[model samples]
Target: MDERDRAIIRELQANARLTNRQLAARVDLAPSSSSVRTRALEERGIITGYHAQVDLDRVGRGVQALIAFQVRPLSRDVIRSFEAFALQQREVLSVFVIGGGDDFLVHVAVPAVADMHALLMDRFSKRKEVVGFRTSLVYDHTHRWTVEPVIED
Candidate 1:
């Protein structure tokens, strides 16, 4: 991708609601040219799907926590099954499988602290694969919506 492509991606990341004309103007490109470039980016799988940010408090899920888990029998099937189970849960927001002391990291949101605890005890603890887990309450969290590409020299 060139400078124009990067600029388009940067602007889109900030606000995906921007109109074609507005985006073209900001990136200093003709509307048709911008459209073509955007389409090409999508075709190349660089520009994935757009997303909306929601307020957890307004949605009745104010409490948030990151739970790191260590599951027994480190196998591909076991790992995939755990990931699928986590994603299927209503309170789960995101799940990550990483190569470290922890096998999985699950981000969850609940109506209250007590609810989070209940979920951990009722759901996670019940799972036979789960050997150990730790929970860390999220007091304040900030996510950078806009991502800047790192160009190699």
Candidate 2:
């Protein structure tokens, strides 16, 4: 919650695997203090968890697409059903239930455009709840996030 805590989060955001000694040095705090603060952040749910970015090309799947799903009878059960089904598919990396105009936004990776088309028609089209969907092919996707804190003089 303090400046030091903010600094620790910044350094960890850059690389989660940094040693406590390194983090403490960069944040200008003692190792024990840094450890305690980091632990507190984790316990308080400020620091959720670490994750690795997966390479789609390395996995033999070069296509990344975002599919927007419009569901019929947009009830909770119908939404949950569509989300669950999407998540269970091999090509789907993540399924997000969204609000606005659509029921769900699904992230999928596939070997080719033809494979994606097949999945759309064979898998999702058969579902009774799916009213419509639109696919957008991703040429590139990059994420570089930050958690910057305001410092007062």
Candidate 3:
């Protein structure tokens, strides 16, 4: 992508609600050209989706925790199954599969600490694949929404 493409992406990242005319104006492109470029970007999969950011605390899910788990067998099938299971859980926010002492790290949010404990005992600990796990409470979380592409040398 060139400078115009990058500018378009950057502006969209800041506010996906921008109208085509607004976006074109910001990127200094004609309206038709901007629309075509944006469509092409979406078709190429560079722009995947738009989302609404929600506050867990305001939504009644105030508690957050990162739970690291070590699953048995460590096969591709087992990993995939575990990931799918985590995603299906209501309390789970995100899951990460990594190569390290732990096989998976799951981010969960609940109403209270007791709820989190219950989830660990009733759900995660009961899973046959789960052998070991650790939990850390999340006090705060921050994210960088806008990103610029890195040109590889």
lDDT winner, 2 or 3: 3
How close is every model to the real structure, measured as TM-score?
A: 0.89, 0.81, 0.90
Q: Which of candidates 1 and 2 reaches a greater TM-score?
A: 1
In model 2, the clashing pairs are: none
Off by over 4 Å in 3: 142-153
Which candidate would rank higher by lDDT, 1 or 2?
Answer: 1
State the weakest 10-residue window (summed lDDT) of model 2: 144-153
Ranking by TM-score: 3, 1, 2
lDDT of 2 at 104: 88
What local lDDT score does residue 20 receive in model 1, on the 0 to 100 scale?
97
TM-score of 3: 0.90
Q: Highest TM-score among the candidates is held by which one? A: 3
lDDT string, candidate 1, 1-153, tens digits = 888998998899888999999999999999999999999999999898788878998999989999999998999999999999999999999999978899999999999999998999999999999999999999987773445563632
The alpha-carbon root-mean-square deviation between model 1 and the true structure, to one decimal in Å, is 1.9
Q: Compose the digit string of candidate 2's lDDT tens values, residues 36-90.
A: 9999999999898887766779988989899999998988888878888988999
